[model samples]
Target chain A: MVSTQARNALAALAATAGMAAFVAGCGTTSDGSDSASSGSGGCKAVSIAYLGAKTGDSANLGLNMVGGVKVAIDDYNKAHPDCKVTEKDFDSQGDPEKATPLATQIINDSSIVGVVGPGFSGESDATGKAFSEAGLVTISASATNPALTTNGWKTFHRVLGNDDTQAPADAKYITDTLKAKKVFVVDDASDYGKGLATGVKKSLGSLVGGTDEIQQKQTDFGPTVTKIKASGADTVFYGGYYAEAGLIAKQLRAAGYKGYFVSGDGSLDPGFVKAAGSTGAEDARLSCPCGPASADFTTKYKADNNGKEPGTYSAEAYDAAKVLLDGIAAGKTTRPDELAFVNSYDQPGLTKQIKFTPTGEVTDAVVYAYTVKDGKIGDATVIK
Target chain B: MQFFFDHFFELTITGLALGSIYALVALGYTMVYGVLQLINFAHSEVFMYGTFAVIWVFTAFGAGGHTSTGGIIGLLIVSVFAAMLVSGGIALLIERVAYRPLLKRNSPKLVALISAIGASFALSETMGLRDRITGFVGLDKPLADYVNGARDNSSLPVEITPKAVFKIGDYSVTTIDLLVIITALVMMVFLDRFVRRSRAGRGMRAVAQNPEAAALMGVNAVRVRQITFLLGGMMAGVAATLYMIRIGTTRFDAGFILGVKAFTAAVMGGIGNLRGALLGGLVLGVAENWGSAIIGTQWKDVVAFILLVVILLFRPTGLLGESLGRARA
Candidate 1:
């Protein structure tokens, strides 16, 4: 009835409206993914990256750390709509081979401003060079190798105590308080294991004069136990993760060495108890850069997890995310220049007040020792 | 002399018992390699998956939790059979999805190797990814609960208490250790009989000797290959059941390193030899334990590799030497 031009114009308008409606429907999600930032002036979406072991042997640890970061992001977004941050996570899998590629990917991404981790110290080294080259500000919740901060990687930071501090403290404890002389040492041959063992050996050497080295993943300690007995060593220091440690402890007791057994944080897991059983596990001392079981964090974490156990490193992960968010708010802009807001992280974190030296290592961190009693880690001694 | 007298039998017995388990897992690798010269890198994962299957089925059917000796034995039998079936099916699927397409395309042998590695990665990640996704949906806890409930119900009468010990004269052995050893020996006997007596096993060996010749003789090489995978996987499933009984809990990546070691055992015994697998596994286990005993436990894995290299260097055909097929270049 009307002119063709008028009809065509109406149709065009209706089609435009339909497309708009479809886009609006697709973009709006009930999930927190679509929530707007709550800042006074809604900031552009900020992309934060988290890197850790996700798929390989250490995937469990990696998954837990990332889980904590996600919780922090969700909580932060809910609290501050203006702090609109989109989180991206990549798994390094505690493998140097994987870490190099993953770090390159994270560095190449222009949207990443701050990073939560590459969980292990060994992995941190693998990716630290790439990150530093890009001027990216990174904080690790668990990387403890002292050598990580040595190569002058300006952007690297860790919230946990370095092996340098922890190992010496551990050696001192075994030799002085425990008065355990003639110690035999074992390491996983990993950066963490070797470094900590070296540190312990240096201190123990000062007291007991020398030490012995063991290979990683060994199930039988009979030869070592024999040697320990021969050397009159009353203490065995193990610098490895839980798997081999548990096996070694079982064999050591079985061999009747009648010596004290000591190890680092890697041996602190409940699985150690399960593997070694009760008698062998008891009286075994373990050292960890202590983080008190956070009642508040645990309560919230349990609630989120429906009362199941949270992963070991989740608290550190949450704290890492919090530090990054603080950095983001201080930066005043969400653009991906990593150093733009580095100064904003000057504030204290949940576990400790983080202050990075020229090389990004924490200047003040503490380690503590615990004795295994009744299939759990317990004790109240801080090693200085 | 006193110390040697006290611990000699204990160490040797312990070594032999542990060696039995290595033998059980090694048979899977040897059988498949005998037929297909392919490593079946996913074999360990098949073992791991079998364990989860046992856990899942035993739990799902309400066989888990505290049980008497008879109840425990019942659960063990059912679990072993369930694991065998599931693992066999998974092996078939892996071949169908990853290997068959490559074979049909006439891809290079290297491609098959890469595909096997990829398949291993894919299977491991699948479980891990499922866990992550479930966590996001708040379903992880509930799932864990379901699995835990089953585990609790299917528990054996030899209770897992810290103080639990089994007395044998002056020496004491843990219930866990005793169970692991007994189960491993039984599996070895079953596998030995199955390979020597079964009609399907002969078909497998014929295909292994010469696939083209077997095909010409109307032996359906494809069917033989499938059966080999099934048998190999069934062996792995049994091994997994033994492993779970010893290890207590399972993880997605649990088989990664252990699988590599088992494969190394296969190679150590001479790739295509069945009896060689058993011998090689026991030797490797004893060697590993002794290496750790001599040099500290930390060196155990490295020692295993060293032993492999040394054996390959001197006796290129392996300790048991080659029995069938061409020696590896």
Candidate 2:
């Protein structure tokens, strides 16, 4: 065995060396971050970027979008191996602050001809200007904020219905459909969550009982639960992502709440079931601008994803990726040409009538109300 | 004000439970500061590792809704020991890797602090990248259950319907909350005693007061440091286990905010004083609760910091007074 003094000296040397290495390198210990944003040296040099929370609260939603883009890229490359396009993954963690730098990064990478998402509405709002100025096309699968369309970003387009259609339908389902007497509206204080909450509360009007706003990534809901209990509401509508929605639902149940739990598209994911506990998640209602995937797309996605089902916005993201890939297939190779192609785009895609109004919203998009039954997000019914 | 009082008991219980977790975590910060004269920021990761250990044990047992109450108790015992062992081991490793070399070279305090910060980032990011790391070794598929969403929150498999053991006012005191508070109080008491009574504890106290003197008096500085980290880390493990039971979720970055809060608790209680950590944590928890009730829930974090600033301005030594070195041994 080495002597004590020698061991001490060796440890000191090792730690100092380790410190040097860490200080010099940035903290990306994972090989998980995909290759460079830009790929070159070919006729198919243009790349499509998937932007959203690849790893943070509600990452499932972002990963769903990424997976969709992946399927599209994999299928396209398989068909044309000689001229295969590349894809980029920019994980924003669904935060606007994080998305800003990523938006700049995406813009700097000239090969990123189009973006599949900035995922949530807040980041979409934050990054839309830069992408618009840079003439980069983005088609979000799940950003449903009505204000996003009003922002006049020529580069902004979405495959799903906006929250303008969703919130009212959600509110109506809570009031007229569920026939709730009292409603308590809660928001996680996101651009997406708050906007939907406002619409939902307005629609509920006299039926609304109380309201509260929580932060993203907040774990404890004790005080909030007390407030909700005091309100004595029959239904609580959560305007937030699935993670927090699941938590609030779990806490509500723990505190002996027997009311209905409702939430928007942000809270509509398989993650909710895992988070809210199987029993607690039952009967919880959700509204989304998406529907069940077609049999073929589900088969393809499951085959590639180890039998993982396509979560919320997966099919729409596929359609969004298809738009970009189709533009590329038709030789609209440059970012500007891709934007031009999208401006006049219309097709019967996988999820909807793949067409955009001047504001870049799909005209025939439908909103569906879903319920959690037996720990699964149950089948959807067209609510609007 | 009225709403707060109306729900005072419930908030108090909730606050206490949360505060206890903070207190347990704070002890790691306070004790490390006491002896090493350095804040172990990676102490949070020590707690985080404990939390993951707790989840892994439960996953291994396949503990869930169907788990009998007796089975849960057995699982809880096993999980606690597993968490303690992992946390304690990690704590010792951290001291050896992050602190020992610096101490050997007589580095500046700032450099030491930076070293600890680097260690902190390295530890948390390494956990966040567990999936990719496992993938490198072709173990990703086998370890998918543990590492599938390394950066995301992984919850306990159990679906618990928290049963109220008692009632106060309109609130029902759940068994989980009671267990969290009691467990924390017991650990704090035990740690306080250990620091005051045991041989290793005496060595730790001697070092905190006068490292050179303690060294002259035949106390092994390295061993003292290791013991300090071990005890502090075990405390964090207890906190982690309770956190798993109470909050039922843990993320890779879960430690960041909680670490900040626990550090705040250590400071508010008078950093380095054991009793101060307990008082500071409880007060911070209840104060935020009451503050939220009066103003709004969104202002809770703002209230916590405002209280900290007030505490710092008036009582800089914290509620108990700073310096474990100077405290009665």
Candidate 3:
């Protein structure tokens, strides 16, 4: 065994070494981020970047998206071994505070020809301006806010439907189809949620009886539900993810608001059913881009994913990666520069023949609506 | 006004529940700080480890995914016990490995602080690095099938997917929320009593106040410090299990931001005081929820940090003073 004196000396050395390492760590002033935004390679392979919450609250969805992209890249790499597609991943964690800097970092990367996502609408909104100005193409799978379409980001593309298509579809079904006049609209109050809610409310102007704006991550929806119940609203449309939406639906049903409950694509998940439970969420109608468990993609997705549950945007993520590869194929970029190469990405792909207008929205798109029946999402119905 | 009241009740309950989790974590921070007077910056990693520990044990014992009332009591006992042991061991190791040498050399507070921060970073990085290995080993479980069942019966309404709702007049409480809140409160009360009434607790307070005096009084200050670390570790483990039940899953790096929130709660509650940590956690949780209600969800973290700054600027002593029974630890 080592003597006490030797142990003491080793401890002193470790303490000194740790202090030195910390001092080096705090020396981040030298712009010493190890995630070198720009690699030295000048296009041996096409680089597509993804910026989203790979490691935060929305990490679950982020992981699914990354998986879809990785799958796409694997497929693409196999198809054309010569035209290899490389990918760079960054985790903004759904925070706009980090999104701006991440955008700059991604933009600085000389190899990245296009971007698959910035995930949440807030992060997209924050990064869109800079990305557009820098002439980078960004396609989002999950971001459904209407604001993103009109934000004047020419380089942006959405693989799936946006709130513009989704909100009105929801309003039409809930108000006109479901034959409900008295309605309460609740938003998660994020850019996506509030925007979607606003879109639905605008469409259902006379039909919407009342509205409530609840912030995302608020665990209890009792007050919002109570207000809806008191308003005599026969239906409620929540514009948020499953976390808050599940709890809200549970409380509304439990509080005896037996009316219809519907939410935008954000609330599309088995987690909602699990969290809200069966009784409260029995008749709940959840609107999403018709892809979760539908026969079209779910059959293949389930097989490929090893029976893993398809999250809300997994299909869209798959489509986003496909579009990026398509863009690379369309250009036939043996060694084309990123800035020049990505500009020509406004073309057709396997998913939906993606072509972005000056505003960066797909020229033509449709929204899919699904109802949460017994906690499992039913076959999605497309609204053309 | 009706809307205000309608929103108030739910927001308050949510805040209290979320805050309790924060409080559990904050207790660890305060306890560690009390003995060492050096921030246990890595306490969040301990919380994260505890979360994984619960997940690991549940998966191993074949009792994974959504704790039922029947299985919950047993799961809680095992998970809590396992987490406490793991966290306690981790905390002691961290102290012995990272902090003990600095104390022996009488290193500058700045040096110790830097070392603590490094240790925190190291732990966080290690947790994230574990993901790479775990992914390779293919531990990815299809949670939907086991957790959510099937979707075939479109017309038939199965019990709400997680059909365990506890109704209290207007409130529709779930078993998950109820357990989270009760466990947090019970833990806090127990810790308060132990620190206030027990001989060991008194010894801890003495050590916190003046290590030299406690040493002179034959307190075995080193052992006391280790015990406090153990307590902090145990508390972190409990907090992690509660957190997972709320969020439904645990990731490798889940504890970093949570640890920050817990630390903020501890500081908000007044760093050395146990009750302050408790109150601070509740306040932060409520404030974040209410802030989300008023502002937007995007600004939730912003609001939380702003509240911390305002609290620090206005009343550094927090909601409670800087002590459990006596003054500043």
Best by lDDT: 2
Candidate 2 residue-wise lDDT, A1-384, digit = tens? 011222233233333333332332222212112222233334545678887766554566677887778888889989877677777777666767666777887787766789998787777888899999999999988777678889878999988887688888898789777899999999988767888899999988999998998888888888999889988999999998877899999999888889999998777777788888887788999888887777899889988788888877788889999999999999998989999998788998887788899998988778788889988899788774
Q: What is the DockQ score, from 0 to 1, of model 2?
A: 0.42
* Candidate 3 Cα misplacement greater than 4 A, ranges: A1-163, A206-234, A242-259, A269-284, A289-364, B2-16, B64-68, B135-182, B197-199, B243-270, B279-316, B324-329
The 0-to-1 C-alpha lDDT of every candidate, in the order given, reads 0.67, 0.83, 0.69
Task: Give model 2's TM-score versus the native structure.
Answer: 0.82
DockQ leaderboard ranking: 2, 1, 3
lDDT, candidate 1, A145-231, per-residue tens: 666888877688777777678888898889777887577776767656777788888877644533555654344444455455556
Candidate 1 i-RMS? 6.6
- Candidates 1 and 2: which is better by TM-score? 2
Q: Candidate 3, residues A195-304: lDDT per residue as tens digits?
A: 77888888888877877776544544434554677689888888877767877887677656778988877677777775676666677888765355336455556666
Residue range with the least summed lDDT across 10 consecutive positions in model 3 chain B: B149-158
Total residue pair clashes for candidate 3 = 8
Residue A273 shift from truth in candidate 1, angstroms: 4.9
Error in Å for residue B149 of model 3: 20
The number of the candidate with the highest DockQ is 2
